[model samples]
Target: MHEITFSTVDKPKLLSQLTSLLAEIGLNIQEAHAFSTADGFSLDVFVVDGWREETEELKSVLERGILKYKEQYLSKRHVVSSVNEHYQVKIEPLSNCIAIPSDGTDVWEIDTTQLKTENKVGSGSFGDLYRGTYCSQEVAIKVLKPERVNAEMLREFSQEVYIMRKIRHKNVVQFIGACTRPPNLCIVTEFMSRGSVYDFLHKQRGVFKLPSLLKVGIDVSKGMNYLHQNNIIHRDLKTANLLMDENEVVKVADFGVARVQAQSGVMTAETGTYRWMAPEVIEHKPYDQKADVFSFGISLWELLTGELPYSYLTPLQAAVGVVQKGLRPTIPKNTHPRLAELLERCWQQDPTNRPDFSEILDILQHIKRK
Candidate 1:
């Protein structure tokens, strides 16, 4: 086994270096861990050979590379026996218990009980999303693990559901209801049988057509406008959080990490997916509703290109690139002029420079009307 250790005062810098190293060796990443430690930080990466028998030579190269990181802070790089960290929940399949409600709009208990506990469609950081039914209706259900759902998380979850129920917007994914039972702390939502926009755009290539893409963009902007008007900020606005039904109706889902933006500095918990975070968020600066707008801006770009912004970089790295490199998203060929303009406005460096959701919605409506 070969190990290389190092440390850095700047987390982002060290991360870039590690990524550079990984990219050089043509190594396929098996697993990786990069978390904050009390002292500084530690990152463990497991990799395998890209080509033929370069595994032994690569190990030797990594061993020699370890000395480069032993300066100010302690950084360690190593090859261990398949470095696998214990992810909090161990989830299994939730039997496909689907029931399409008579109303064809909502789901009920009789629908949930039929869930095959043995099957799981998808799992997120906070919960596992299952494909269950209401009658003839198949829906995706997000159930929080008993031990994992803390008071704070629950508060977030409840507030999100409440806010969702209050607002009836096209872009916003409508909330069903929570399973009140203990241990089965679950939220039944509109079954976006097709899954998240992230999966659709990146994973499900060839699925999106031009009109559908623009339609999704228009829907998302409307949802953002709704939230902003309601004085809410979706801290975790990303493709993964955006759900799409079979009809291709896109709804913004998962407001569990969202917050009501009253004052500028409304800090809740350090919650959210890092990929979509704005630059100011990375700097630990006080952000407002516009920060959510920033995420929407990124999402819009994703919609246009069908690519995740700065996907090649770590979350921290992406944040820094947005800040330092003035890294804006690239537009795809044949993108509409109005969309290109609107997307640019959304990603303005100064959050205030970005257009508000009201204006965004107006522009989208005008574009679609044309």
Candidate 2:
């Protein structure tokens, strides 16, 4: 009888291992113990194996199992295989970021080995967000549904690579790298452990604090200011798109909707979510950076109110209310008066009249200081 433990892996591996070993000599498992603990899991396996194979064959089979599982196991990266070999594997390259060092030796590529993948963090029309790693550093990986996403989206994936290769900003979600190989349309980015501002505002209210909110506002403003300065308009600015670092610093995300200055006039065949979009965008009028400004305004409202403005309303309903009923977001009764005033300026009917992101930055900074 040999007792095996799984600190991480759950089922099939252990059961498969037992079955495979038993099948080797036509033996049966008489006693078994599969116990779980916070630290790991344990299994006491007893077998009825009176007749056995040659010693060399048994060791060779065990060796194969060890090597295979070693690639899939982590947190124990340097796993021993067959008492003769040791190895570690990850899907991502071994570097702090995607860029290779100028002098060489820093360059690496993804190993074909299947990796340990976590459950989805967020799933959308685009794909599922997964928290994963390469080498040893943490990373956030987005896995797109190949068949579901059309060829147009594949172009957007290329655009992300182009954008990330040229741009850098403190408050923006940094793109680390991308996987373009077959069966994978993965985009990698720096891991944001704290999640998004939306979580802090509504979902995580029980754990929210004033200091965190102030920091988030400052970081958000900084990120927007960077985009505005670069003449980039993030048409899809929303809560789920905003990501946070371990320090609670906010970074504007989803530049897939961004419009470069020359391309700013291009229009989507349809439109973004009506609730967060400006009336002009909904009307399909010629628009500019102010479109993002409008979304930012709603995002701020979400921060103050601890709920998405008009989130309870359906898309058709929100549009009707905005166009006909003139539904405007109201300030949270308990919020600071100064913030209420800034939000009012942000949601103004005339995009031209709204403060530019440069001015917006100043306003948020002032509020943070107070």
Candidate 3:
């Protein structure tokens, strides 16, 4: 067993790059585990069929691959579609240098002095979230814990910030700016007064009528539709990641685990809370935007019933049941027939069978009209 561990900014091509490196070094992987840390680093461990003599060669090849894909790993250069607007992000090879956009874009480089953090709103595997004030506007600030801040972590944070800056949708959280400085790395976004859907359902014991549930469902579907249309996969879509404004309109938040789809449009990584995770992701199978649809189905189930999926089981148990037993949250008998059918379609075992959010949005809209 060769123990190789490295941290890099999350990217779609990362797994392929590593496997290619191993093959070039004449090493066959016996077993592999790859997952993303909530703090924005991809951690991969591989058990390979190899000997001691090839260890040095394997390291060399790995280094070369890292160098070749340095930008993809460290600098997430945004695709600037405008012909006249020329900007590209570049990273110094194997160094802890910050990425610089050749031609500056609208990504705000926030001065730490301008941010005034208030009370702590919540905490997660990534870090603590706080309600803050920036530029006289209320903002939700996600401050990555000190120990989690590293060179690769910064790169990932930069990627997410730049990506959010490019996205514009009412159902998506508004990105304000980020303080990229170490020991205080923070992401700022427009504060959602109603908090997350998870909190609304679980913490507040809120009960949603069918029409209200449909409205929330439609908001999420619209936001997810926009994300999918942009070729972005929200690898960790869940009720906890869905925020609600004071108007009760839902917006998609938490892009720490999100990634731009590669040319092949397939991602191989088990990322997301296990309870809401797609079976493909749970099985470490190649997945795409359809994974998000699976998660949406779970969220819809939660909305309709106001209960957690597999609440009696631990995360590991839920994952096992989902992968081995094809366990899905039960849709209440009273649910609208159309809505029930929609949920069933979203959580189909075959990814291709899952309806795209565009189709889901139409179904939801039709239900809302009644």
Best by TM-score: 3
Q: Candidate 2's residue-wise lDDT over 257-338, tens digit each?
A: 5656555453432235666877666654457777778888888777666776787775545655775566788776877777
Clashing pairs in 2: none
In model 3, the clashing pairs are: none
The TM-score values for the models, in the order shown, are 0.67, 0.65, 0.75
Off by over 4 Å in 2: 1-116, 206-211, 263-270
Could you tell which candidate, 2 or 3, scores higher by TM-score? 3
Encode model 3's per-residue lDDT on 147-199: one tens digit a residue: 54545556667778767877889999999987765556788999999999999
Candidate 3, run of 10 with poorest lDDT: 79-88
Q: Is candidate 1 or candidate 3 better by TM-score?
A: 3
Q: Which residue ranges in model 1 land beyond 4 Å of their true spot? A: 1-85, 88-119, 134-138, 263-270
| Top-down TM-score ranking | 3, 1, 2
| lDDT assessment of candidate 1 | 0.63
Clash totals in order: 29, 0, 0
lDDT of 1 by residue, 1-370 (tens): 2222233333444544565665565654433333333344343333333534444566565545544544433355332222112243234333233221243454334244554343588885567877776444555677876645545456656676556656678677766565644457676666776788888777777356657766887788788878887888888889888888778788888877676665644542233555677666554445777777778878878877777787788555665688778887777767789988888888888888988877887887788788
Models, CA RMSD each: 8.4, 19.6, 11.1
